[model samples]
Target: MFEAVIWDFGGVLTSSPFEAFARFEAERGLPADIIRRTNTVNHLENAWAKFERAEVDIETFDRLFAQESLALGAEVRGKDILPLLAGDLRPEMVEALRRIRAKFKTGCITNNLPANAIGSAGGRTLYIAEVMALFDHVIESAKIGLRKPDSKIYRMMVDALSVDPAACIYLDDLGVNLKPAREMGMTTIKVVSARQALAELEAATGLSLR
Candidate 1:
């Protein structure tokens, strides 16, 4: 029933940045999940959201995020979180994408910062570029000024892919991002772990993902 498979780049294709966030928080002696809390507090218009949409520059985001976190009882600099966003790639997930791409149209939608945002850009950029090349089409929030959980972005992908929502299968680590696709008639899979997500995709696509 599905003609296309859509993926979210960050948490789905790679190890989650949230794991890095927790480690940062623990090392800093701040409250657990504080970074997540700050990001979620004013989700749509917050510093993190603005950065992803390219509405704010790195310095501006750093100041704004620090202020936002201070208000929530911790003063974490935004620049500190930038390095944490570059998670190690999951080999199995990358292999799965290669297999799936041979049979179905594949697309990636990611909410990301500018290329220069990362502290060490050389290796990271090359690795990400390699993975990104596997997709037939890729949409980035920083490049497009639209982030996920916005139904418009989801519509944009289906429109770009030239596929109806009902004929697409979407995978995202965030339930908030998946909800709109699911509502629009796409089969949605919420990725918790690589193993679990692959199993779910296997059932949905009737392919041996693992």
Candidate 2:
């Protein structure tokens, strides 16, 4: 029923950054969800959102995030954790991308940092290059001055793909990002696991990844 498949990169295609954050937290004796809390401190207006929108450079994000962490009683620096966020990729998601590319238009809607140039999202250039080759169109927030869960970026994806929102199936690990797609009439899949997501995709699109 869908003409296109839309995906989120970090938590969906690659292993979740939250996993790394939890590990880092465990190793450091810090509070759980501290990193996410720091990023979500101001919600959409947080430094992470600003960084994704390309409003602030990496150095600025590091300083801003460090300050946010300090406000929460953690002295962690954003720079120290940035390099470790390149999560190991899921081969299944890559396979699903290729499998669906043959029949349906595929796009990647990711909230990524500017290229490894500014030290934000450090060590991500090669991985981004690898994934970019797989998509028909890549909507990266850093390049376009927009980010997901904003609803407008989702519209931007629709315009770029030239597809009706109703004819697209959107997938993201975060419920917040998926909510707008559902409101826009696209079928939304909360990607809790690759097996669960691919099963839903097979059932919805009849493109079997198994």
Candidate 3:
């Protein structure tokens, strides 16, 4: 049985942040494709990786992001970029997490930018408090200076949880990010939907759901 569970925050916890970005783009009259293109530089995951590693701080990252947008012929600002990071907690996922926490040590590993840069909206502080408090540990890329798809952060989570990688089940919304965890011998789940993920977790761990 897995002794611990590690979860990625974005797509797995709630709706993908990309949906928020799409809404933001439409509201601002910016090209919808610009956000996707910016994310793809050095591969679609590198921008977050660099931010999480502290190789680029928030101010510099914002300036560079704005420059890239302009270079790509889109008019966008740093403030306009904030919604891309907003997280919406899913009720079913929250319930599932509560159940998982009861049965296994649980933690979250996410690539997040500085909170100050993103600012607050929709009662975000409360939202963060509710979701983050659910975990035994939370390793944020911005705070920890490490981001995933990178193996180092995964190792860090394993170490922080005081569990063997083989004893942990790691869940991420992206196959690319989950690949490294799977390689390290952690049971991995690619979350497609809350219900599907819950069913998979039940199957893997023999933990009954409510």
Every candidate's lDDT: 0.92, 0.86, 0.80
Pairs of colliding residues, candidate 2: none
- TM-score for each of the candidates: 0.97, 0.92, 0.87
**Where does candidate 1 stray beyond 4 Å?**
none
- Candidate 3, residues 147-183, lDDT tens digits: the string is 7777998998889899999999988888889999999
- Give the candidate number with the greatest TM-score: 1
Higher-lDDT candidate among 1 and 3? 1
Candidate 3 RMSD to the real structure:
2.4
Q: Candidate 3, which segments miss by more than 4 Å at Cα? A: 28-32, 43-47, 70-75
Which wins on TM-score, candidate 1 or candidate 3? 1
Clash count (model 3, backbone only) = 0
Scored by lDDT, model 2 comes in at 0.86
Which regions of candidate 2 are displaced past 4 Å?
A: 117-128
Which pairs clash in the backbone of model 1? none
Tens digit of lDDT per residue, candidate 2, span 18-103? 88889999999998888988977786888788988889977888888888888987867767778667777888988888889999
Residues forming the 10-long window of minimal summed lDDT in candidate 3: 43-52
User: How many collisions between residues are there in candidate 1?
Assistant: 0
